[model samples]
Target: MPTIVVDVMPKAELLDPQGKAVAGALSRTGHAAISSVRIGKRFELTVDGPVDDELRASVQQIADEILSNSVIEDVVNIDFGDAEPAADASTEA
Candidate 1:
């Protein structure tokens, strides 16, 4: 099976109360080195067949139109999931 991953995050200009709360807790727990945190969402779609161009486009549509709110959220990333999901570009070779 193949999988697709979508990452959605609140628009940067808006405040993320949940993320702020988590950051506060982390700071209180001695994670002082971390200054801030922004929480986001992850969606994984497992498919039975090959992940081709058509499927990728479809998933992009789903991410932009269905998985996120245009008023406050943005679809920040898309992963074809050919391998283990990397948290960010820094983790990839």
Candidate 2:
């Protein structure tokens, strides 16, 4: 089994009101040290099967196809978990 992590967010060119609201709160906290803040959603997917470049590519493709709309959306960051290789012992010595 392998785990896949995907992050989907609005493009920098797009307007993010929610992010703005959160950012505003930052200043209220008396933390002027922070100037800008962007909020986005994070998703974790667990897939059972082989963990290879092909699988990762497919996942990214899916994110672009259905998960996100490139028109006003952006998705380029993706992460994959460590998969344990199949175990087999050699009896021949």
Candidate 3:
């Protein structure tokens, strides 16, 4: 099975009230070193087979249409867990 991980977050320009409240609480609790926090959502999907281009497109569509709000939220990342890491081109030399 192949796993697709999607991370969704509010746009950087938008205010994050929950995150701000949490940060304030942390500071009050003596964790002042932490400057800020942004809350986000993560979705893990296990598909039947390898992640191909078609599947990738479908997943992107799903993320845009259902998993996230394009108005105020954005899909930060989509990761295919079964895919092999690309070789670092710089390391080839």
Candidate 4:
């Protein structure tokens, strides 16, 4: 099976009260290194076979139409499970 991972997060410019509250609680609990937190959603879709262009497009459409809100949220990342880490990417080698 092939899997698609979607991560959606609130826009940076928007204030996330839930995240703020969680951050404050963590700080109060002595986790001083935690400065902030932003809440988000993660969706994983497993298709029957290898992910192709058509599947990718369908997944993208599903993401845009049902998985996230475009008004105040952004799709931060989309990953095909079989993809290898890009050699030149700073986050992954």
Tens digits of per-residue lDDT for model 4 on 2-91? Answer: 677888889899999999999999999999999999999999887897787798777777777688888888777778776562232112
lDDT of each: 0.81, 0.69, 0.81, 0.78
lDDT of 1: 0.81
Total backbone clashes of candidate 2, pairs 3 or more residues apart or in separate chains:
0
**lDDT winner:** 1
For every model shown, the clashing-pair count is 0, 0, 0, 0
Error of 3 at 59 (Å): 0.5
Residue-level lDDT tens digits of model 1 in 17-92: 9999999999999999999999999998898789877987777778777998978987777888867443452221
In candidate 1, stretches whose alpha carbon ends up further than 4 angstroms from where it belongs are 83-93
Per-residue error (Å), model 1, residue 78 = 0.1
Tens digits of lDDT, candidate 2, 1-93: 667766677889877888888779989988798887777767788898887778866776777777777786666466666553212211112
Q: Lowest summed-lDDT stretch of 10 residues in model 2?
A: 84-93
